[model samples]
Target: MYPTHSLLEKIKLYSIILWPILVTQISYHAMNVIDTMMSGRAGTTDLAGVAVGSSLWAPILTGFNGILMAVTPIIGHLLGKGEKQEISRSVLQALYLSVVLAVVVYVAGVLFLPSILSLMQLEAEVAYIAKHYLIGLSIGLVPLFASNVLRFFFDAQGYTRITMVILLITLPISAFLNYLLIFGSFGFPRLGGIGAGYATGLTYWIIFGLSLLMTKRIPSIRAYRLFSHWIRPSLSAWKAQLALGLPMGLSIFFEASIFSFVTLLVSRMFTTDIIAAHQAALNFSSLLFMIPLSMSMALTIVVAYEMGAGRVKDAKQYSWMGIALSMLIITIASVFLYFLREPVAYLYTDHPDVVALAMSFFLFAIFYQLSDAAQATLQGVLRGYKDATVPFVIALISYWGIGIPSGYWLATQTNLGPFGFWIGIIIGLTSAAIGFWIRLYYINRRFSSLRS
Candidate 1:
């Protein structure tokens, strides 16, 4: 049986493990909220422009983020095993690979933005604004990918606080930049929605620079990269990274694309007001999700380290501890969101219809957080074990087979509308959580028995 601790001890441990993650997640989303608010002030068209453009932009960026996610577990295992040289080499390779990937995606977005926007069937004004925003946002892809590579490297080293600090500074800077650029303040010309894009692009470079500076200070990282041996990429090492990364990357793409597809479907059925409201609720939920996300990340490092150290039992304990903490944090956040629903909605928009629609979606958001926390934590645990492919399959089935169909049925066939759509999300999340947890349990048991 797992060991139990005092409630106070549990809370303290959870705080130590989770607070940095919570802060990073909140700060990241706070930047988005600030962007939405600033652009909303520009005009309704500006708000819709950002929303639609982001729908396309975020998935592509997140796909690259998936590649970096593959780096963390490998680095964590290397760190756990005291293979410092290997860790350094992995970091360098990840950075090089990420830059290449970013270039490919950025060029694709820039070259295809006009055509992509046209395919979305958006109004001419909305499409024009979205295309302009994409052009500017595309410039930051390399920096964003660089930042993520650094984040995974540091996280594997158990220095998550570094990311929290970087985000704290970056967010305020981004917000300030947005204010000046979007409004033509500080003698800056008002570029409107495109200005918001520029602020976001600049912030990515700032984050990348700060992360690189911090990495340079670490003796291990410095030694590994400065040595001539580290400059060459191992074909085997690259293959290993790709083997571990591609499935996980595809899994992320699958999940994100499902949401993107749903957003498009909803746009087909509703007005811009409804789409904006859906975006607000989705953004808020995604922010809240960072709490669990951060914990899951922490758990992945802890579990991977423990496993690498040949402490299988300890690894299992860490997984349970992380999951318990994630669920509790999400539950508390859900209650807060429930009571403050109206105020939360107001933060995004003042339109009565949008506000009402956002509130309705919040109802589903509250419930979904529990399942999301569970699944994400388990997924993190799985990453620690190098069990990526199975989880990918489970996610595909849950999101596509169950979640999407249920959502369409309820939203269009029934009278639930946007609320119906979120109901599908809730179902998908629950299925994923249960399936992932079961998989983790069995895998751990088998590994433990094999070791014995």
Candidate 2:
């Protein structure tokens, strides 16, 4: 039987794994914030272009990456069950899946993005920048997906700090590249907002190379033989991963797409300044989101590890611990947002009206912070139990079924205008929180019965 831990021991274990994951997560989200901030400094059109491009890119990337998130639990399960030999095979299959998915995403983005952007009625320069920015960013899809798989593989084995170190090393390089490419400094071409995309792409390559090196160089990880053997592509392995991953992917897609759709809707209804402001508020909120997001990720690792070891009680306790920690942290962040909303808004742009409007959006963002944290952490808990399909259905119903339509009706038909969408976001997230809580309760009972 697996050994159990006291609450304090669990807390210590969780924090050790969590802090690095948190930093890595914060660093990743900060790259997007950096892109928005630097692009804004370039000019209004550039900022709008990057914002629009990011809107189109975010959901797709998040959804696709969500599919790869399966690697964590799969590998964690193997490790927990003392099946170390199987880890390499799982990683290989995940790598194969990543390549296929990346290619599909790239080809689709290349072929269909222009047509979609055209329908948006964007300004000429904004359209041009947005289109090419996506093209540049798309170039990195292969490496980005590949590196993420490796990251999950490492994190699953409790090597969260390895990925964290890799990200920290690359984060500043991404910023410098953005500076040089965006402003045409140091003899680089002045691609403006488009450069941000290219810089991001190049950074992906660097990150991938470093990740491969880590797999080989790290003594403990090297034992897994991730690189030493070539495993042929296997259809059965692919199906096994997709069985668990697809619903997880779709659930994430539904949630992320709602925000992207909201941005698109706002673009159709408002001016470039308004879109930029909306993006600014969205970007900063996304940054704060990384805190809970990281907690959720850690929860997935911890919970899955416990479950794989047949320690259901420990997994349950850890899940609650993660949720409580997330709530406490988000409460502090919301207060910070409330007191410094204007300054935070101004960080994105100098335009007085945009800053004022963004500050207003921040208030709505603050309202949803608690719900967002609760739902995100709860989803992470559910993922630990390998319960994804129902969350996908719930996300579909709450986000598209309830959230978007209500937001649209309020935005166009009522007095709330753009603000109505934010209200919709709050409503949707609150619904998700409640839904996930109920689901978790039932799942816990089911697991408990099985244990008895």
Q: Each model's TM-score, in the order given?
A: 0.93, 0.98
Error of 1 at 113 (Å): 3.1
lDDT of 2 by residue, 1-452 (tens): 12347999888888888899999999988889999999999998899999999999999998989899999888878877999889899999999999999999988987899899989988899999999889889888999999999999988877899989999999999999999999999898999999999999999999999999998899988888887889899999999999889999998888889899999888878999889999999999989999999999999998989988989999999999999999999999999999999999889899999999999999999988898999999999999888899998998998898888888888889999899999999888888888999999999999999989
Give the clashing residue pairs of candidate 1, or none. none
Model 2 Cα displacement at 124 (Å)? 1.6
Best by TM-score: 2
Prediction 1 TM-score vs. true: 0.93
Best by lDDT: 2
Which residue window of length 10 is worst by lDDT in model 1? 1-10
Query: What's the lDDT for candidate 2?
Result: 0.91
lDDT of each residue in 1-452, candidate 1, tens digit only: 11224545544554565578678878877877787778877876787788777777766666568767888888877767877767767877887888888888877776877776777888787777777777777778888887898888877766778889999989989999999888999899897777888888889899988888776777755665633454766677667888888777776676676667677776667888888888788878888888888888777776777677767777777788788878987899999999998898888887888899889888888998898889888988998888888888998898888988998899988878767888898898788888898899799889978998
lDDT of candidate 1 at residue 346, scale 0 to 100: 84
